[model samples]
Target chain A: MKQACSIPARAGIGLKPSHYRDALDSVGTIAWFEVHAENYMGAGGAPHVWLERLRSNFPFSLHGVGLSLGGAEALDQEHLANLRTLIDRYEPGLVSEHLAWCRRDGLFFNDLLPLPLNEESLDVVARHVEQTQEALGRRILVENPSSYFAFESSTLEEPEFLSELCERSGCGLLLDINNVYVSACNNDFDAETYLGKIKAEQVGEIHLAGHAVEHLEDGETLRIDDHGSHVCDAVWGLFEKFAGRCTGVPVLVEWDTNVPSLSVMLEEASKADRILTQVSSH
Target chain B: MQNGDGDTLGKIVGDDSKFSRRFSVYRNNVYHSLTVALSDAYPVVKRLVGDDFFLAMARTYLDGGGFPVHAPLYDFGKDFPDFITGFAPAESLPWLGDVGRIERAWLQAYHGADAESGGMNLEALSSGDAERISGLRLVFHPSLCIEQLSWGAFEVWEARGGEGVAGMKVEARKNFIVAARGMDGDVRVGSFGEGVFDFFERLHNGKGIMAAAGDMDVSVVGEVLGGLVRLGAVIGVEE
Candidate 1:
């Protein structure tokens, strides 16, 4: 059978409750929609109701911001169970999680945190991913995360590490282009070179979001991958590059905080759609 | 991994030197994030208490407790209202629990799923059968919530002031309030009386409309049924 989620190559918006009615009222040809799985973990209510309705009209990708899949400790079974419940209910076309850990031990940072690429940590993560995939009864897409710092204990490059994960876990990739751009700039690497090393066949989806440049205590600057604003010019350029390279992959426009109105978001989706069309037609 | 929770926390920081200091950074951040999630989930309570006190109280709450799981922090503060009562700084603040409850309910309402509209067509019922509709058992939405509070909890929530429920009493008395989301996406709370409660109790128990209404005044039954239908709480009717 095909993977659970199948977000189309066209542009889709992140699902927000404020736009629930507007989306239901006028879906308007948007190919797919994504929701933070954590947002709809409840047994019943408006989120479930709107999601059920919206799912009828469009394909959905359940993107999880929590789960801390790459954390040093054992994966939280309860979190995994909740994820399993959501997967069972929605049967989301695509389910993706970040290749980062937000919690250590029991304290959860509630952010997409960076991971130290070492053998022990890798073993832990691979085991967890395998277990999580098995529990959900489907392969999951692990997206590369944007990070402010890299640990000195790292052994493998990010792409090589991700490639290893795919090899071991038999999962797919939700290659987040903006994360690559932001992390490469922060860690002083070439975005194109970083993107060039990945296996495109495993890439099932793409994420395009905005970032902000923040000055650290040192003289250097760090690009914070805050999905609060519109897609920046550089990120857009990177997305266009990736789309050209990997056509027919679903593209998601994520704007989590400071979410704009539905019309504004749909406009952004249209812009991405136009470029996706250009990339594919070529 | 005997105590995976503690060991995992120790590993997250990854520094034995200045364990307290490094651990503090991770602990503080986690606490702040979870506390903020609580505050966000219960903004009305935050507004009720000033930002400063709310932050202090949140920190205190975190100092005493840890998240139950690695799930989204939404469930972390499900018992926060009860926790706040034991908070020393908040001793004088009795309605804080109610405020917290309201906030939790609001968060619940905000994220609650919309239901498919359902109701038996009232027009189909014959005049004689229509009268029996009042006695029919009614089904409540899965998200329907009824919270009872003392000291005008609803009024205080509606006011949204920083005075901190100044004159409100914190007695253990109950206030009957029904919380349900309307069809238009408006979440509302209203006073539910004994009559309303009994009517619902009967309807929810699968009692027929006429039988459910048998003990109640005919006019009161009609009014309650009409109100429930208008509230979108009663989705279907069967004779």
Candidate 2:
């Protein structure tokens, strides 16, 4: 009786507790939804209850932030088993995690920290991705992380590293356009070039979110991936470009902080839908 | 972003002169989100200490370096009560830590295991002789948690909206507070008399009827048994 519906390649929104009730009622235009797997790892409770009812109405994707897939140590067995339990219970249409590490050696930072883009770090991440896919018995899309600063030892570019990660592990890329633009501006790289280098066919999903331009004490600008506002014109433009390439991948609008009402979130989803529709028609 | 002079992040932004200033965005985000998570987990503590102090305290708690490895923030703050007891600033309001304990218990119960609350198989229960009732072992609902506190934390919780509790004097009496989620999918907190709470606590810990009921009034045993069953708190009882 507990299960999930299959999703289409349309716009979806990240599941937030504030919008769970409306999500259950139904947002007709939205094709599916995603949630952080860490939030649902509890033994049981209201989150599962609402999710159960909503799962029947909408397909779900288990996106994880705390699994530390890119952690240098061996893949965490307990976290893997917990994820397995969710996958079995929900049978989500897609499963995904970020291409970043938040934890290492039994310590967690509670944020998606960037990894070095070189041979050694690549191998560590690929092995972990392979282990996760094999354990879940499902292919997962790994989202590109939004980085404020890069590692000095990093050799390969972000897209080249991601392309190799996919080629080696068979995991698809969840291209977050905002992350592309933010990272590009912050680190002084060309966003279009970054998008061009990624193997288009390897992209299984796209993400669009709002970011804030924080002015530091010094007269300089830094783009923060806050997800507190609407998707900016710059990020949306980048998404339109990537949307032309990936063609039919589902695009998700993630609004974590300053979560507006369900109607506001749905409006964002509809905007993504418009872009996706235009791409499909073309 | 919390800014620092560390050159590591700056190396990533190779040509940038304002690396620390630029890197402050991520630093700020990480601290902001994690601090919000801490506040959500410890709302009563937030209410007691107010926003600025609570956020600052949450940061201090995070800097303690023992935040659970790989656990969701929902299951976070399990050690917060102990953390508060040792925090120097909070020493003036000692009961603040115990209030945190109750809040954590409430969250655990709210998110605890889901189970169908079963009534005692009356057919199995009634057929037993009167003497057999005293030896029966009982199972409490899966979400049940009873915390013994030496402060009027529940009184503070109950009086949340009636009036502000700023200058209220709370008596420190031995209290066994109950946190239980019913089948209707709501978690509620209440109090249990010392004897009754102990009897259930012992039974909850896997003790059999006679052993768990030690020192409880025999005359009131039937009353506690009936009340607990009517409340759907007992799942299975071995006679």
Candidate 3:
């Protein structure tokens, strides 16, 4: 997996350990494979061995979820060094982080957490992104996280914040359509409006995933970004509209939890490929 | 921010109260992810306790100040096995801590670095170079870990999905379990006699060859050393 290992601007599915054998049996199928950087941080194990075997077949996208890019504290140098090693070794087509904080005061949450979209937090996030890009010596992509809460202190909308961060830090955007849909539905906004704000050129990639619907006791339903099922029709509809915006950006189907059979994931990727084919000419 | 719930989110980020209702979702995400990681790490412990009990226990572990100290959550529960010793609900199960200890050792060995450190390490020692060997320290494989259990809890672990460790004898179980990474990168677990366990434990504690060998039984030392070499658990002699 190197910069020359191209990911055809098609749809790919996350290469989970459970699907590794099946994925190998069917090569030249997916556009690329994406894995969480933290999952590979171990010094050596079966994960690395399996990943090494798969790397020869597909380009990779190292998506990091635990960098705590939006934290108030300084960027973790040790983690950055490990990430640099990964980038140097894999030479992934694209590397990405999130617009969220998961660690505070040396405590790790291990989940994508929201941040206050204010000037202070934005400054913190931009500095971290710059530091990361400098450390990796590559242009990295920052993802839009699904939010379950909003802060009064958040002055900038997520799209504006991400846009400015790109301008300031020379990074790219990974516009996740599923996140926009889940966040919009959760926060009382329109998903299309969220995606409409993102310019196509800024987006280096697109993420589409499934989320769970949790019904509240107060008779209100909230969408949780669980990534444990098929991409709902609503999210698929939004991805269709969003695809025309980014003509060649690689789209990924992520199913992290309750991962079904490999065939099911391939079906989702096929659905995305069909959609991408339908919209590519536009 | 402190409570990490919707109300705390509102106080820090939101001026309006309308978003407070959405806090449970994020809260569930955080706790659910943390518990899932813990559950993955300590599956046997979760199985020992049912899912609901384990989930509640994991939530308590989080709420009672058990946050991960690193970026990646791989080493999140470094102290969890130790934490289980004092937990009240599991107090009735005396062998629980020992099982936890063995599982933790297995995980550590599995995640440890790649080491082709094995060699014909003990070959020269057979020639009776006593003085030279005394000053020489042995290099153990990077993934090697030796744990002495209160009982042979490996039986329980092997039977995790089956009859479980119910009514297993603690008295007859003088267990010394060792975990090491095989050449093929899988973690392998084995149990050794007391003499072999002591020899490795002494070496792990940086004891000199003479000091460790003095405590070793005469007959088993040959068998144990040969077995360790065969297992590729021993690295070269360190000077």
Candidate 4:
């Protein structure tokens, strides 16, 4: 069954170990925090200590990166159990995983691999999502991935695939606006049209992140979702447009690589908050 | 796409040259992320080998099908030490494998389970009968781990934050290191002499106080026990 989102409709930042002290100190100043579920899968230590302490003060969302929810193999039960334990302990306001696969034949590729958008793949993903929801005993949000290439064997579009998966699995969508923008640029698609096709009511959260623009050898510009710098202006524009329509959806600013100081992250969140405020006032 | 048959997968992504160029993006992302994970786990090892060498070494490691079998990245590089031991390129650096082991131990202790309260039961040591107290076994914390190496791996690990291994001498000698989460919830690593090492080794082997001490001096035993308690390594004492 679908669980109602509990996170406030404001700006949040991805909680990194480097920002623990700053995050703890600025509890009320920030809206909430999201963490990669796999990072804290350890039994106990500084990660858990900081998470336990900060969780007492602010809300959190467990964003998983290792579920391999779209893989052809059976689900990793051990990983799911660890996630369940973490959710029970942290009591996060929201939980989400990507609509991508990272494992195959018992080997984890350590990257969000692209999935073909077709009926067979859709059935596989829907079954995995349903199994995950049943295992966790709560509905989760499946995020769209930033792809570099499209599958020729695909019969449907990305939004249509996600919409059908959500319809079948009774899950929600975690709209990563930057991903939409990145995939749009790399795959030559209309970002606004992609956004228009998404069911806003099914969106439980919004993700904002930075991406790197790489000029290919063939004079082609490919957008890589690295999340290493500040959220680009193009992504911010998409987020603003999406936020205006999907008002009150929680927004999270994620910067994982070459992470800057806590102030820079807070500044990004503040920028998102400004857009959200300006949009809601309209 | 699931298998390594690139030709079949290449057909699926399309025959366009742009698609081929873009497909390498995913391959690069996977390799880059896995290398970063390894570099993070073995910072000292990476520093010792230098960035270029480390990158090449990690490339070889990944190409040799060293992908992690599990989803948790933290548990991915446990076999890296063993891999380094047999790695031909690193043959000149005989101590690199031990250094990797030490770093792995540090990471394990950092993420290990927390220790239970009431360590050592000092009252029991003070008031119990001498013979019974001497026979008491010590329960160590889950995070506590001892590494015995033939080279000065601990020295290299300690030098990670300083000037680094540049212009430094690495002595080939028997080394004993104890890594455990301290009372303050920080992973603490310390090198010790033979006496302290022997005592900890015996205790780690499930030996009691007197049995672990063997013929060692009583004063050194007391000192080692004090250090263990300080490190939060000794969780409980049982008869």
Where does model 1 exceed 4 Å of error?
A1-5, A72-78, A103-109, A217-220, A280-282, B1-36, B66-74, B90-92, B106-141, B160-176, B181-187, B192-239
**By TM-score, is 1 or 4 better?**
4
DockQ of 3: 0.61
Query: What is the two-chain DockQ of model 2?
Result: 0.54
Query: Which has the better lDDT: candidate 2, or candidate 3?
Result: 3
lDDT of 1 at A268: 88
Which residue runs of candidate 4 sit more than 4 Å off their true CA positions?
B1-16, B123-133, B164-168, B193-199
* For model 4 chain A, the run of ten residues with the poorest summed lDDT: A1-10
Question: What's the lDDT for all of these models?
Answer: 0.73, 0.78, 0.79, 0.86
Q: Is the docking of candidate 4 incorrect, acceptable, medium or high quality?
A: medium
Interface RMSD of 1: 4.9
Residue-level lDDT tens digits of model 2 in B1-239:
13255543326645555555545555666677778777887787888888998887887887776355664766667788888878999888878877887888788888888876555653444554657776778767798777877777777766651356776887776677777676666777775566577677777888877788886777677676665665555666776
TM-score of each: 0.78, 0.91, 0.90, 0.94
Error of 4 at A162 (Å): 0.9
Tens digits of per-residue lDDT for model 2, A76-171 = 788889999999998888888988877655766688877678898899999999999989888888999988777778998889888999999988
* Candidate 1: true contacts recovered, fraction: 0.31
Off by over 4 Å in 2: A1-5, B1-11, B15-17, B22-24, B122-136, B193-197, B206-211, B218-232, B236-239
lDDT by residue (A1-282, candidate 4, tens digit) is: 766677999999998999999888886787899999999899888998899998888888999999999887889999999999999888889999998888877789888988788999999999999999898989999999998888888899999999999999999999999999999987789999999999998899999999999998878888999999999988888888888789879999999999999989999999999999999999
User: For candidate 3, lDDT tens digit of each residue in A194-223?
Assistant: 888987888888999999998887687888
